[model samples]
Target: MFRSNSTTDCVQHITTSVELTPIRNYISELNLVHHSKRVFKLKLNFPKFIVICNNNGARLLELQSKVEENWIDLQCRVRGYGIGVWLGLTDLQREGQYVTMSDACRPRYSNWMRGEPNNGNGNEHCAMYWITRSGWNDTVCKGKINFVSTFKDAMIFCNNLGAELLELQSKAEENWVDLQCRIRGYSYGVWLGLSDVRTEGQFVSLSDARKPRGNFRNWAKGEPSNGGNSEHCVIYWTTRIGWNDARCTDKFNVACKKQKEIAYD
Candidate 1:
């Protein structure tokens, strides 16, 4: 009887293992599908605004009826690129709500706090700048100055800052700066914004006196060595060096600058 029981247990173990094989394979396939789905969502759901500030500020702005459920899908168009106090304040203002001037983009500010307000209290009136649900965040500051508030009560804030804002706006529209992808065997670089040069060493000059030539030189040093009889240049932005060059056909991240008009329909 003992020998018979031992034989029975061995057969059961083999049967269980075989049964689990298909289940395991199914799980692996499911994970792949889940990952692909996530990438699809990201590509489809690109944030309109490159930057957001005051996590609480973002949350308060989202509370608007038009934004109640689909706030993340709303692309964020701010006054500037990257995260900074200017970008943060511009983001909040662009939302068209009353914001504490102090809440403007301070790098040290908390993202978590920005999203959720009054962690310390239940009754504090949230400071915000109000704008129509359909209005663009920058529109308030763009023309006619519809609402009035102070960045600080005692200090004077100038609208000339808006000129700088306009410059950033133009840069974004031009799409001249693009990011390049890493190549298989080469150090990462970007494509300059030029094409069809007559000479191998030719480079483009900046139209604006303040703008730097040679593809974000301060950011990408020792780049654009005019690699081996290459005559064309493409503009690109790099995380490590700001901007630099590679061969025209090389793939990289692109910064396309265009004024995106927000239409609430």
Candidate 2:
């Protein structure tokens, strides 16, 4: 098992992996890597930025407290400064009600600059951290912005590796996921790619928006109650030994699968 505390080993792994690009400033405390700028050339509008990060197994950086804020600031001073980086915060749903994208959690601590979040031009809906000032600012969501990303969340954990959340298309695939988890001694269930977020009770694959083929579903008995309509995402329930609807925001291990290229005869 890779221990996050083993900085030397972590750095070695990151250095050797062509897929990994360590986030420049704050790489020590968090084992995060910035996705390739080549994917979007370092400039993307807020929504696209979120999508890009998600596609690459990452989430936009979130600052939980002043201590974390200071760590980033100090690292920026040590490395160098850029224009700024987008945060995982937005008020798109309701003005003056900024929320984190991962869980819709309201920030318990904030370091907004004085007179900030003024909703400038009545369109600044996304939040960013200015490297030079070390303060937060709300900005226009339409404008392209460079950003720092974190390999947080199950969706991101898989996407970061050029793969996607597992889709159990058959009993064989489902059994494989279960056997792997059991062999590895996973204490909890793994996330599945299916979800009904866009339309209630209509589960679709997150990677490609494909519906399940030919009525193949292994839902656990009494599952998918859509409890409070909050449980939109699906997980392979380890305890129940079948699939169940779950809160999308909650963290879990993920089984990622990438299609293999088949050679033509």
Worst 10 residues of 2 by lDDT: 7-16
State the local distance difference test value for candidate 1.
Answer: 0.25
Off by over 4 Å in 2: 1-152, 260-265
Q: Backbone collision count in every prediction?
A: 42, 3
Per-residue CA lDDT of model 2 for 137-234, tens digit only, reads 99887764321121135566556556666777788767766765554334346777788889999999886787875557999999889988799988
Model 2 residue 241 CA deviation in Å: 1.3
How well does model 2 score by local distance difference test?
Answer: 0.61
lDDT of 2 at 234: 86
lDDT of 1 by residue, 127-206 (tens): 22221132222212211111111111101111222111112223343232221122111123223334335445444432
Candidate 1 residue-pair clash tally = 42
Model 1 segments more than 4 A misplaced: 1-192, 205-219, 237-239, 259-265
Best by lDDT: 2
